[model samples]
Target: MIAFEPTEDQRLMQDAVAEFAKATLLPRTRELEHARGVSEDIRRTAHEMGLGLVSVPEAAGGQGQGLVTTVLIEEELGAADAAAAFGLAGPGAFGRAVIELGGPERAAELLAGFAEEGGWDRFGAVAWSEPAPCRTHEGFATKAERTDEGYRITGKKAFVGNAALADRFVVFAQVEPERGWGGIGAFVVRRDNAGIRVGERHKTLGLDAASFGEVVLEGAVVRDADRLLGDGGEEGFTRAALRFFVKHALVVAARAVGLSRFAFELAREHCDTRVAFGKPIGHFQAVAFTLADRAMDVETSRWLVWKAAAAWDAGQSERDALLASARAAAHAFEATMRTADDCVQLFGGSGFIRDLVAEKLMRDAKQLMLAAPTAEQLDQLASAIELGQKLDPALVLPTPDTQAIFT
Candidate 1:
């Protein structure tokens, strides 16, 4: 039931995206880096192409094209400019969070606005990470106290993507503090919410085209309807949340695959042209072997990502899907870093210069590794599932209680 070949329809879409990447993103990568965000025209183009809603369910005002297609498109985007993919206007992580945590019914109402007029200017984010762990509780520092009409959320969420741009957020908070990680709850908090405001943006080593900042909720209240109580309580909600993270990581891994591919190609081209001792550098044993290894890295990462994405699409068990995703993502993330590093190494002194893209690739690859759960964390998850151990909420997934990952 596992298929590596994309559908004919998928091939067409891939080609179209590839062309857009080459013509638009690749050329303007430096421009995006300087601008510190995706240009409005490019964001508008991506929106018109339905790039943001590709993986969303049809019932939730999306294409419902499934995860496999999503990874393919993501790879194309990453190959051109991984940073711009994050900067693209759309629900992004917020859409995936709602779909996993709230289901289609709630997502329909919350997500329908993304397709409206001027929707290209809209963005949504998942406020999952925190500035620091809650010292008193075993979960998030952010708390949600029950109120007459709803719950009032209060705390600071850091490393949140599109924080300043997102009008809507799926904010995670400590609901039943006594229950620890099990007490966590998710709420839909709008930017217009009286007590919610964006804080200072972080300047990172890479992915400058995307904004990562803090969301401070000093008693932001959400109505009862805003609660995304998946299947209802602790275990169910935790399971759904874990699934979302793994699937989201898989999507990020596909991008890593593309980054690896681009790096490998860039290195190989340099090796073929650059002469070291009278012949092309690629003819040397060391350089040739490195290129060969990176070639394997690209193909291996792509297949792993495809298999994991296909598992979800094919209705595999949650444990199976999670395990596959963890392995794929872990491998892809490391391979991307290695490939980019080698790409720089092959370029000698020139790679370090800003005039070349090698250094940027290296930095982007490193930053991307943190955009989701780390390879180390993912390996722990894979091992936990393999050993048949009870999946502890804190141990099996990245949480505010443990490592605060960028989402």
Candidate 2:
């Protein structure tokens, strides 16, 4: 039978990450927000704490943790500060992808530096979004033209996580337009390459510490050896991309659950302390019911997040994984936003100000909603799965008003 409780090692890992997040990430929230990026000291501390290598395989000099453990760690870190968690988790996700999909030599090269003695000093990124009318999976305008030497990639990717500081980027581009989604390929390009340019950071509503920005490939050339999955062709590329997207969706869901839990706890504590008419606000029926509703929402979302992570760790079929992830993403998004809004409401006037963290959590929840595979899109994917339709993994339903929003 499947178990809901974490294993002994998993429990220990969760506790350790929770402690580290509270001690390190929570204390620096204000500073990190002002800086618009996590400090080098905070990054190094995360590395030393082994947070950067939790998901990398043991063969690659990492802890060899599974997706479930990674989700647990992410939940705690996100509870402390979602933006800080993203900064630390982003490279680990890239490292894991390389280990799983990149060819032997490519994996060795990337994993070697990732396992460096000092820390995971080298940043890695994945560029998938592009400047195009269609931002869905089939809408990628970036083209990879074959040449005698290798391939020349030309396009601009917007909203690239960790772009400003990334040393390596796994760029997605179309290699065979006639083949549609199957024609897409992921090519590894170095930041210092001849035509690669990292754009200025974009001012976002939240998750500022993630350093989200643009990456431009003006005919950036790379040899065949640089391609993830090398000669595996379109099928291989599609498989790798789908797996990564599913895993990423689950992680984002876990983060949302964590943020929701954090907001609920803060609101609960505030309700107990803030008194009105000689009694604590929590004693009031309206305040008590709101807190109760949010507590239930947080618990429900947490279970959904764990269910998706557990499905992934069990090696379920791709369709099953996608369905679980989509459900989790949709539920987590709604729950987190509702809980955050309730938190602000509970705080009354203080929540609107910067002194309290309720407003910050609300902003972070909104930013997460805008991230890839939005709640509406995930809901569509889930609906397709239920109907036994094998929809394109990158295909997102477009509404008239939201058509341009994805780009």
TM-score leader: 1
Determine which window of 10 residues in candidate 1 has minimal summed lDDT. Answer: 396-405
Report RMSD for candidate 1.
1.2
CA lDDT of each candidate? 0.90, 0.77
Residue 215 local lDDT, model 1:
95
Candidate 1 residues lying further than 4 Å off, grouped into runs, are: 1-3, 400-402
Compared with the true structure, the alpha-carbon lDDT of candidate 1 equals 0.90
Q: How far in Å is the alpha carbon of 326 misplaced in model 2?
A: 1.5
Model 2 stretches with alpha carbons more than 4 Å out: 103-108, 134-138, 229-236, 393-407
Alpha-carbon lDDT of model 2: 0.77
